[model samples]
Target: MDTASPAKWVPHPEGPEIAFFDTETTVPSRKGESYSLLEFGAILVCPKRLVEVFSYSTLIKPADLNAISVTSVRCNGISRESVGSAPTFADVADTVYAILHGRVWAGHNIVRFDCPRIKEAYAEIGRPAPEPKGLIDTLPLLTQRFGRRAGNMKMASLATYFGLGRQSHRSLDDVRMNLEVVKYCATVLFLEASLPDVLSAATPIDELPITRTDTDITTSSNETSVLVAHIEEMKLDSSNAGTAPSYTTVPIIEGSSGFSGYLEPEEVMTQHITVSTLPFGQFAKMAVYHKDVPLHLCCANLNVCFGVSTKFLDNAGRPKLNIVVEIPENLCKVLDKCDEVAHKMSQEAGSISQWRPLVKKDGYVNLPTVRLHIPTVANGDHAIYSTEMYQKESSGNIQKLVFTKVDASELDTLFIPGNMLDAFFDLDVYDYQQNAGIRLVAKRLVLHSK
Candidate 1:
């Protein structure tokens, strides 16, 4: 049973305009190790028609004819004497390219191993490699379709399972068997689920050739409509704030000091404070006392205010605070545990908040967080570039924030602000103690006015 012979080739008409190909090489490694193409076979099928079947098998002449012994023993059983009189790779380049042109290449495990090796062979022969654009991997398709019910479906196993004849390792037989699988996949899975649509969606747009002018015109129109809608929505949802808050100030000095008889009196006071936590059923409030005289009170709903704050100081040194109030401690824990999640959430919130008005319907907003790698500088603070947000459909899951890279500049710029302690005063005590303080540390301080 010589499986390599072309006379045994059989093709089906119901398959796609697909080329089922298989290559037998001297060695397995695609790069580093040299491998001669021992045999190549292809079965071309159009919808309901078997167009062509081709096979090219010849011994490769090695420079050191003695080295052919290794390949002859391992791959196709042929000796050095047999290949000494055969044609070189240069002789078959045109025929191979002619057969492969403008065809959707189909092969099992072609993505991981076979396709790369074939391309490498072409490069070695001083010819351009086959375009990967038209390639279709059958392995992923099979996995997606039959992964759940049919565990570990190998090419041989799939062929056997589908009652498509045996898949021999020889090039010609493998192509025939692959054609059968392609037929089965098309009839059983593809047509039912719209394979063409799936393929189009999976393929990147730049790879497809624009053959007709109408396609370009239609694509341009669709892009313009999307841009217009986005602009209109952004206009509707513009935010009031120009920039995010970094710090906020509170007015502690009431009046300027008076000078009498070359003596000036400055108001300076220090107070000891005890913090007490109170938990309401649906909320938490923090109270700061100077011997039971309430100095500051903070309240928040756990669902809304997540115990995070951003404060900005005005020119007068007075602080205006933007607090992420009513936030639960558990959710804060999740954010702290995952820094990437925190960064992503911050980016999304900052970017999407600008267009909040456009997202009128509940859960209509889709905010996608972008992750970037920032390089670290030696001494200076790490610089953070742009933060853009994409609104997407809500996933019904907590959005994750990720910080991909910490550059030297970001490390240098990182500093603990002086007012960070005062910002803690703004957090609901009960929520901080129960939800935040358990996982995070907070220190208190008193500032004297001059």
Candidate 2:
């Protein structure tokens, strides 16, 4: 490796220029292993303008019999005799680097495996590795975007989904499939978003879908039993209703910063409420109220129920409710109730107006319409006005609130810094909710300290 110089390259165009790259290696690991590259290929595409294809395949001298066993010559169609006279890894390193230079690198699972392998190969060859400015991994992206149905999003299935033909395991075929994956990702998954935008938004970790069917494996034996009981109660409610209710179970993903759903139960006088649930992490809070009077409160790190809402039914036909309690410790009194407290809560729930808006802000300026907060991270307090309007905008939006009490320095600490504001723009207000009397779900929050 040339220690003083590394290959520097900019990514292809922001919108459509993309390079689909794939490599077939002798073995997947680098430590205590040496195997030759069987094939390497790349496909360059510029949307409707041009398509360039390049590939290189050469046998290599296997270091040992173990390398032969790992590669399975029958699968790769290469023999020990074929690689005896082949060129060394150094001879072809520059050609491979030239094809990948200055392009957004894309492959089926490039980020996890192919990327590291290529970098290692460059290090071994005493040449600076070609830097792929951006990467698009199809596996996790498909899973998160479409749930379990897309979990097994293999190259073949993705190709079929996009009407791309069969892809052989050869280098050129694999490169073509990689290109198809990019097109599908850009048009369908990214919804015409630019390559840089998609890359910038790419998450390195897998974020599982929020659903009740998914369980956190870190629960204790006792907590596991409680979760089972909660599911059982939901089943009982569904059976009692006679007809199945339309419902979907949402997983309370760990580290969720704010409330996910709200509860407005019909019964205003019921006491002895039972909540049986599992806490996903180290903290949770439950605030119980009868109408408007606070009746019970508890905090723990394990899941329990102090209140329930049977309004929403999960896909498995169970009544779902907004569980507002937070878990603060392993075991903090699973139940809380007082006769006087119950009565006060009942009165408060009864007195609450049915037409009250879901969100209330003291100084909210109804600027005659809703607006988008592009490139801004939501704080989980404001309503996600409309998915339809959100889809129409080329970008996202930011939520801005003026605080009268805080100075500029404090405000900077609370909101996005002014230096990074140019990447965002104020969305058209007409696309958001403007009705004063309408209740809306506050999906995000933005804190403006001053």
Candidate 3:
């Protein structure tokens, strides 16, 4: 490894292009293990023509070769032998910084993963990391705008969906593929936006009709069932609804952030139990979210066996409601199924809502957890909210938790964070305001003492 450190980088033109980049790192073998940088690849694209202006890619000799496990090699095909003679990241930091700093940054899921890894690399080398003029995470951006039509937002899946061949997983190849994927998706979206009626009639990209049986109920009065009323209504009115409901701007509901289909605690609980009647016997049970499976292709159902903590306004720019809960492994499998089903549906619908996976990194240890995003809608003058809050009593009666905004503000809350509760929910899909994907909609919940 080179011992000399690269000098601080200064952009000559102060960023006239969009910097698209990707990084390949050693997969952490154990919990809390930091990612070791293995490679860096980037390309500067002309914003006007959407063509590549400059490209750079290099393999980096990690600080510790032992960090590169067999799994890591399998993931990216980069082995210690391949990078043994490569330059260290410290040697190329200046070039990487120069190509990145002050430019609009674009990459697949960079905001969640790559961007952080770059910052961490800089922090390790005791240098200031590059800052972007604007950040565009293609994963969420496309998942939002392009929809899941191409399946999961992973670069490999998107490439395959568009018949762009395979993803090499190398930093340079991946970044270039990322740009191409974005262009294809943007073109499709542009065409659809320019002509909605024409596109709607065309069978959605990568989707077939889902033939759900009428065995799926359509009543709100049921105690443990899915309210298929809206699904049925959509089927009946779909001929005329013509994307109206999906983008309905019928004056945002006073308190409920414009979210419709609001259900009370009992109503929510019934819906969960109702849809979950698909019987299972031991190993024959089905799952939605599997760790090894792509999220858009699978689904899941989770049981929050622990008490929940409910709070308001914890997350900025979102509704004040949040319910944090833990997913027991047994339920994680089912919840994964919900993810798959909802993801496939969202893609077929060409909806723009982002999918939030139930099983996250650092999952499967002491029970993986997920947040129940409860966006409240108005009920007359009061702001009423549906919660992932569900209760199961000792007698086995399941109930949902309904809280008013005033009740949440009081903080003498029924669903306290960090407190365990018995809850039942479906990983249902929603496309309100073009925000699509699966969420844990509580059909049943139990609140313990105080």
Q: Where does model 2 exceed 4 Å of error?
A: 1-17, 28-31, 34-36, 47-50, 53-66, 81-85, 146-151, 160-167, 184-450
Query: Model 1 off-target regions past 4 Å?
Result: 1-17, 28-32, 47-85, 148-151, 190-450
Per-residue lDDT for 1-450 in model 3, tens only?
112233243344347787789988886543235678888888877665565777777888899999897757866898999889988988888888888887778787565467767988898899999887677666655665566565445677788776666789888888888876766665566556668887742555665533333243121233112212211221212123112111111222234332233322322222132121123554222223323322221112222222223433433332454465655444555555555665665566455667667666465324467765555556777555554343333223444344444343222123423233444454544445555555665544444321
TM-score of each: 0.36, 0.36, 0.48
Which 10-residue span in candidate 2 carries the lowest summed lDDT? 386-395
Worst 10 residues of 1 by lDDT: 415-424
lDDT of 2 by residue, 1-450 (tens): 111122243233333345666666553222123334655656665433324433334444433434553224543555556566655557666656766765556666555346655776776667788765555554444444433332235566556554565556555567766654544443343332335555433435465533221132133455344433422232212112211212222333335433223222222244544222224367332234444443322111111112222345445443332222222211112111222332344344442323322222221221111111211122354212111110000012222332222121122122211101111111110111222121121233321111
Write down the TM-score for model 3.
0.48
RMSD over all Cα atoms, model 1: 25.1
Error of 3 at 336 (Å): 21
lDDT minimum window of 10 residues, candidate 3:
241-250
Backbone clashes in model 3 = 53
How badly does each model clash, as a count of residue pairs? 40, 41, 53
